[model samples]
Target chain A: MVLILKKQVLRRLITIRSFSYDKWYKVESERQKRINKKAQDFVKDKSVFDLFKFVTKEGVSEFKKFVQEFKETDNKNYKPYLEHGDFDYLYKFNTKEDIENWLVSSDSGYKIGKTKASLNLTQQNTGLFSGYLSSDYDKPEKSKAIYTGYANISSLTEQKSFKRENRINIDQFNCFMLKIRGDGRTYMMVLNTPSKYTLTYTYMHMFPLYTRGGPYWQYVKIPFSKFFHASHGRISDKQYRFEGLDVKSIGITCMDGVEGPFSLEIDHIGVLKDNESTEHFAYETYKIPKYISNT
Target chain B: MARRLLTLNLQLTSLNALACRRLLSSASNDDKSLKKVEKTEEKILQKYLRKIRPKDEEEKEEEERKGPFKNYFEDEERNKSAIVFYEEYFDKNTKQKDRDNFMSALEAFRVTNPTKNLYLDFIYGALLKMKEYNAHTHLEAYRKLMEIFPIGPIKCLTKWQRDNMHFPRHQNCAIQILEQMERNGVILDEDFVRLTIKIFGDWTHVVRKAKRQLYWLPKFKNSNPYPIPSIEKLENMKDIEIAFAALERMCMSADNATRIEAYFTDDLEEKTKDNFESTWIVTAQSQKQAELLKDHKKSIPIFVEGPFITWIRSKMVEYFVMKTDPDPEIIEKIKQNENYDDLDQNFKNLHNMFNDPFRDEFSKNKKSDLSVHELTDGTIFALCCTGTGTKTSLFYWTKILEKQISELKDFIIVYKIKPKPSFLVDLDKLKNDFKENQQKSN
Candidate 1:
């Protein structure tokens, strides 16, 4: 009886093992079927759009020629200052005497600390904004003792073309390229719009010097879309978009809180108009009102 | 007897021979019949096995045929077949899943045929144009293609990185993939983040949005704990003071401040601390200026050079310091009770008072009636001086100090100049004596 019982147990075990094997095989085959279906579907879908075509050399030259033609025929509306290599409108502080007419000096130490800034022509006759910053945390309890030195392309002066009414039409340009040499410190490019009877808020773009402590010149290209709006040293919650024509002034500031002397050299500043430029407003987060309804 | 025995033996032998012959005949007949039955059973078993085995064999064969390519020749054949499949099924209504399958198959082909893989670029271009394709699908196809032919997609990404320009749809798709990867707990490399930023961070709006989303990514948040405020939240805020205050709150959150401090270098950390301190001082100064401006009918020159400004600054500091410090007695009482809901409500009230002082004063007054004794002397002074009635201050104080003051419910707390004399000593005679002394001096 014991032998018979043992034989029965062996037979049952064999049957269970076979049953599990069959189940596993079914699962694997089902998975393979799904993968096969996906593979087959992938082969069934391929088409190309016109935008995928690479821009060739001839295409670029042709586009430039077209832009030139557009400028020449439409001279009154189209002004290509940098495209034609026109440096007449470009602001250059070639000598110490010329600095007064072209730029205004601002330093935070004048009010609280002992920060001083000087603008001098380089030995190479290039425009330079150099400054000494000191942090005096002892004078007042609430004093930050920070010193900042900056120079603005004064729009209030005798240059009528640089006035608020005669602002450059940025809609026709792609970007502003500045040839600058700096000492690795971060710098800010500030632009202001014309306001009546009140101080206008400035829009600023802060970028760091790619190379530091070297005399090598770096050409920095800043698009108008990169500037963020600020008023009185505070970032604004609302960003107001203005056309290139609306810009009244441009300036550069360095205030990284590194207590030492800093220097920045300027070679030239100009605008470039490239057809390949993506013109859509880069910031898509700003809300746009659907309609101007009278309340 | 011998004769009889021999005869018996002969008889037995004959009987035995007869029995043996009969047994042999029967056994042979039985064997023949058993053999026929066994052949029929074997034939039936073969038929049953044939019926069940074909289905499994066909499935196995199909899988083997579609499995990974064995050699370059097989890969080439598969590629050609895939091309034909694509050409045949290429239509506007072709589903995204079908395109993905074809790309995957081509990927498998490319894996086997690694050299001279030019067909992938064509497929990628075509996939780029498909409206049904999104960032995830595009990413999957790109990744598979990369696995087989790593050079193609890398080259494409490099070109896009160099030009710093991408179609809006492509850019959006890349952002979506990055977000999805992050959501799945995948830690993306810095290069991926940098590439995404390069492609989409050009516009102010995109950068603002990306900054918030990227800040939460494990890579960004782990490295830098600063909470990036959303542009919508910042833009909707009308007051700069309130906005900066909100920023301060975010910076000071328990999970963030320590991590952010660790992220900053020594010098940067010092500067950041100074900046925060200065911001609070500036806020306090501004609040004082606003309060002063509100009191006078005419505009006043609040920025007096000498001691006046310093005095105002000191006062502002004092007010802020007093306002921020919670009463220890009340805190102890709250801790003892462990009534967290009441504590949270009290904190809410404090925040409301900080945000807007006058909008819901009446409602606050009604709520404050039950808890008035918690008011510190300095708080009462500030409330009265600021023209928020004594009753409101008492009410606000009680809410915070309810538990502490419950024992003192029977006592009426008030400011007393001097204790009343036990007996009435001032009489008309004392007044007359003082008057006579005054007359004598005159």
Candidate 2:
């Protein structure tokens, strides 16, 4: 089943654009192997029916619809939306129901011991992502593995049809803005953008979100150009500018390695074009010089 | 008696036979038999050695019995425990818990425990005590702590030694010190780099951690938009003074029209029978927000919400906001005034409106660009962080505001206070708590 999905995504990628396909395919396969290895550490093997425990009945229908859309749609009709000229909220946490739009998960659920994280509304009606992060892991028998702590609150990815993601086009905006109250901790805000490869070759652009913890709500304006592409927690050597054409979701991750209670209260998230910022991309997109060659 | 002697003689002869078999096995050089003979010989040798070096074995047993740490409180005549020692050395020796005293404590511990047996315990203990002395933020304390570990010998010299984690416990402790320094937002200097290299060598993990700190710390040190004063300065300033600085930062406006007002609670007209120490209230109001407060309807009640928390560095300060409910009529007007920012949505709406002859209303021109100030569900008038987050204190806040905006006198203000539970209520703390408890019981 996973193989079929992989082929479908690869086909879509090849149809849309051209690249060094063989090299990317190698990198993607290597990444998939690493993921599978990590997954195997927790469970011996996952059968096809075991996948149903995660993918619901509705998910199957969604996949079917996605396949149908995949057949019909092309690069021309991909995520066509009017460009936002002014500030508009992508996600607003004004009420209890608004908090439901985000899904919270942590390493604890994957048999990692003791760490717990959750998201809920505070008395002030803001979404409070709070929990204790513990580094202690329940060691499996004869396993030489170390489990670190990580808890993330990710916004749900919307799918219009059989589409992988109902991409929100905010190309007109330059800055991603949010109002948040945090406990003086640094968080990583990861932007999920569509890539030409499989899910393994995820194009995640992340930037540090430094929060000044206090009573006052801080309005942070991070330029989209500041985001640098990273996959599997490591930045790519060949960097590229962040194109906000098909943004799917944003994830806020807390993994500072501090073992204690943490909290982040979010008011709203939006996008705007800051007139002051002149730099197109914070990091250089040119290929880094390699001193050594395999040949 | 004869039968027992015969049995003893047979056992001695068998021992001789085994010794003979060992000799024969060595001569023959048969692999399996030679291996079996060597194993028995090793067992006999181990038994012989145990008997020979009984004192050395006893000393090792004694060392193991003491566990991972040495008991510094072994001197029972004076009965000075570790806690008492800390109190005497840190508290009684110096009244001021400054960097000097902190270093002196480390010096004193080193002098007393010269053997440095289980030094990791001492380092861990010192780390816990450093927090109480506020020495966790001091670079000198970390330097002193790092200096406590004897250098040179523990340093991993070769690549193999570095890879295998030579002196792992000590290296980890050093990394932990660096981590704590990072946590306290301490910027490590070049002098510290030299010290780390000298102590742990260039290739050691401790040096790598220090190098990482040196690289990353400077980048994020000045990144905070609302930067607080140094811990040294904050340690000296009063709570109210700190609150003023924080409130000033929080209420900082781009136009520079935000006015800060401070007054003592004792200055209020309403006084209680029992006079206690007065607390200061630091309130901030912008000129535009003050104008909005004046124009607010007298019939509509204003809400003073929150005992919200904001951190001025590590110190927590509770604050309140005075705001009016967002009127739906005004919200609707704002909505009608707002333009569809999406070009496609505007085009579609225009097409629909043009096609229908009966539809007369077109997209209205945007009234004004929506600023962050208008993004709130409620219009905030003023903000304040007070020493006491009580209804009476908030009422005094309104009374103070009434002097600035006279129209506030006619408005009915409602306090939505959810103050944190603290011990200090008044001079007679117990009595009021008892009364509140009784009221709750009813």
Candidate 3:
């Protein structure tokens, strides 16, 4: 047993290169490189005294946090910067700068998966959202369930706390409209509702965005009522109508698990007032069961 | 030294004599009792032999026994693997590890551990083992696994108990089973519902999950707009046929004039033939697109773009599109007509608009054909996903299109193919470099 243990120790000391570890190291080094670049940019614009002031400010904040035992920040007076405009266009990807309003993230940063989301310019000056989606990832050592391959671009959420969020009231509009051209891939349109409880238990709804693969843009108008209540990628047992008045933000997600290149060009996202058709909610919503009530 | 050795030998002999005398005295007192003691000793030796190497008779008897968990629980090595259907069941001589074997294993485990106390570990082990056995896809397997949980007296009686979930571990185990089934795209049924209610009680979280799946799963099961045939049907179909079906579904319109055709690469003229083996080219073009193609000016270049993916369920088909450059005049016309103000404004002046019927007729006359192919980027003439995404295969498609629309022959087609990966290009160079390095070493 002693000899076996000694062999194991020596084997561990050799540091065999593993795919997951190499990928994790690559991501870490890239992050470090970005930080260095940002530092260089900071130095280019500022004097040494300005750098000292910035460092001191950061140090003072850290000292304050230490003294206070790192309490929860109460930003009750923080105002959201995203403008509230006419319901004609909630999000318009007209220029390269418009990409900043949308945050892109995927499983690659967290796991040994490979995915990317970037802005490409189309001839129409529309933002072409393209990505290489891959589900092939290193499985965790002890886990039986493996999950990866999801790429998302979400509008920036403006919130001070779980209770307070920058919500736009689109109660008048019955349908959510988008003008987009895609390569016939299905995407999910996610609408966030303000969380009444903890952020861990988020309340959101999603519907499939089916794009017709062609040269022309397709105007898809999905009824707000068609959005189903789904939480953390699972459909909720208790069905509820989407609360349009308490809307927080919207997002687009591609997680079909088909590894290939995908592109979707967006002209704009708008809310339409459809007067001809009248449907409240697509799914049935009854009274909550007695068991859930007890909870 | 000799005297000391003799004295030690005498002492040893005296102790042996003393032990013999005590045994003789005991035997003289009760002869029958001494015989009985000897019989018991022989019986114990036989039992130890049986324990060391159990015969086929013993193993069969163990199988016949209803509750054989006592032996299984006592065995440390068997407990570590945690599979109730031991190596004997999955041996080379026995049946293969499949759905039936998996079901039988669950049945055997349930039959043995009737009054189950430490069943949570077994359930978890079975859950992980389901994937290895490839039984996760079967609804019947999930049903049988759920039936493993014992019912009746353990059922929750009160609302609070049910809400808090009586036997929370067991209920959670059942939930994980259902979640696994969902991940594998298995729909819950009436049998599943009955089992959930019977084992976990009606108001428990497990039952609620079942109800949710029942309500939602079927609603979206056939919800794919570009629906292909069922997965089983698609399995037997040729790749070209499946691709054509997906193309047909995507190009389906109310007009019913969309032409979908498949061409074989070998059928092409000898001058254009590129592959030794035949490949297929499936193309779809609507009447509107054909008309648009005819109206295109010959001076401008038409671009053949893509290798773009369109997922028809799990299958990813790559198709190319024939398109023209974005026309600014057409974009401006589209922009001018996108006014929602006219929709609401018409209702306000309903009487005035109705009084002048000629004005309404004029507006109706000016209305253009609404096609998804007409866009600011360009007008799409046709789309085709080939067996091989090569320029030659695409050329056959354009030739086919040319026969239908003669105007396509006059237009210059430009190919904008995405370049092959750098590694593929560098492989030959790397081979040469390796050869040079080997020569230098020599």
Candidate 4:
């Protein structure tokens, strides 16, 4: 069925007149987004519908309102906090250290971990199945959903020089693919005194569908390695006292490692899972009135 | 009254939001066997993911799990749990027939059910690019669509009425809908007029939102009416405005964002090639664009889309001129014909006409009971007067005309009702004459 569609569209393209190119291009590109990618991949293989297989650094072919990135000024309480104002800061990150210092902070007794009030046990509300995401859990299986829990540093409002990011920790299980959105380096609209941004993607774990990164509203998927590297903790130890870098606090940060109101909209956040296991939905996936997907 | 699409047969399953929750988070299991990359260091991670997939789904249903910490979508399963809730709602709550009906009805695009309808009252705008009475089908589609969106129709009607000071009559469906909402008292005076316009053609809106929405439509997994442009008729006429009414309707909308796309130059299927910025109106319904085009600098026309610009650059007008006039002199006539100074004026008239709050010129020229309908027709006519790659200005059929003119006796003076791109202008002749006059100085 899909093959017939491919033939029909290509045939039309062959004969389309000179100017309709834009409109045709619109439909065609959108069409390609819809069926073309899958069909082409299918040609590469018989039945390749796996989401990861389709993640050609090219993202999934679906649109959601959440994909939109907005300036922090527009609506303060909007979902999906900004990693930094305008997606540009990350392009300037000169080294891993620069990003690390900016991403992780020490808040006296409040590192970037589960609040002292809440134990790592995940207050009943923060369980993996139905938890609110314990701050203590950087693990995907126990997430505060980066908006609530991610690289946090101190004194973002006032900065003397600059700060580097602590590496992210893309654990082995995380299927995040590190996909770049713009000319590989996204341009930031807002000004960063330091003038740089370092961005790493979490790949094929069906991100973009989840994290919705940055202010420009582009898809970002990172490899587990990049994810971990971008989110990893700093190591500080001497014979006297060794401490694994745990985020006690973070303020507004940009990729340039600036202060205050850093924002990032992760397009999707999931480590790639290699599976097409036909597990029946706990509730049968069925159609609804006029709209919606079946589980 | 005459519907373009069939009535939507809204079939809803019991809204066991609870049962739906069970299905929502737990649908997919973490299958380790399927993902045997055989690499080890990562195996530990997969093992962890497997343990949490379903457990997370179950947890999402508990009232405590969702609201507070839902923002942290760190992994696929929980991320899937929250984001995929809508899909889950449909899967568990709906029936197989309803799914098929939803899929099939998308073709008809008419709202069938009053409740549980998925895409109700959602503002829908299409640059029909198709002329003739049949264009009214879009109206019916617009009307029905207004009926279904979560809060769209009622909001549209009330907002329309308040904006119009009464129920909108003789206007595009959007205005009419706004008026209807007012009469129905389904919405408030402060309801966002812009949003209502996006759904219908209020003076402030254009269907650009719909265009952007459709632009991103392909990104969804298993979207209903997957493989958009499902029907063959929609295939070629994707963005072609069949008539002035097409654009007029969208222009009449209250929302500034009316999605307008330029038809590509017929051959480019590549994204990089399609990146012409002069085209594609990112700034929808902004007065700035209309103002910019009037400047002597000949600022890029905001309405002109990238593909259209490419079309102009493609020497398509040259192609048409060659075809429409085989005589060198005749081709010269079309080429020599300039619409700039006066053309700019004409463009102004059309712009003012299009920008007119009442769309009076459109109302005057079009054959319609609704002023909205008439105004929409006028806007489309203006576009047709320019170029749209079809029988309009780009002259897709002009190649055939060229063949005919070669055979016809008096083909030198073929006049195009619309202006086309000009290449090899007679301005060269003026340059030559200027040189001759300069020789006298020598």
Report the lDDT tens digits of candidate 4 across residue range B286-330: 232222222212221112211211111001111111111022433
Question: How close is every model to the real structure, measured as TM-score?
Answer: 0.28, 0.63, 0.64, 0.18
Q: How close is candidate 4 to the true structure, as a TM-score?
A: 0.18
Q: lDDT by residue for model 2 over A1-295, one digit each (tens)?
A: 9857865885577568864333344466679999999888647546555566547766788778877777877753553343233466788786877888888888867675566777887654678887777777654433433336889988897767535467777776678888787866678899888666686457788888877643446778899777877777655645678878877778899987666667788878877655677788876545422431110
lDDT of 2 by residue, B333-423 (tens): 5555433333575532211111222332334343444333343366778889778676766767787898888888788888877654221
DockQ of every candidate structure? 0.01, 0.08, 0.12, 0.01
**For this target, which candidate reaches the highest TM-score against the unseen true structure?**
3
Model 2 CA lDDT for position B54: 50
Higher lDDT: candidate 1 or 3? 3
- The local distance difference test score of each candidate is 0.41, 0.69, 0.69, 0.29
Q: Tell how far residue B166 is off in model 3, in angstroms.
A: 4.2
CA RMSD of each candidate after superposition: 36.8, 17.3, 19.0, 32.8
Ranking of models by lDDT: 3, 2, 1, 4
Writing each residue's lDDT as its tens digit, candidate 1 over B63-165 gives: 3332221122134435545433333333433455455655645455555555634443334333423323433323344344223323233332443452443
True contacts kept of each: 0.00, 0.11, 0.24, 0.00
Q: Tell me what TM-score chain A of model 1 achieves.
A: 0.57
Where's the lowest-lDDT run of ten residues in candidate 2 chain B? B348-357
TM-score of chain B as predicted in candidate 1: 0.20
Minimal lDDT window, size 10, model 1 chain A = A80-89
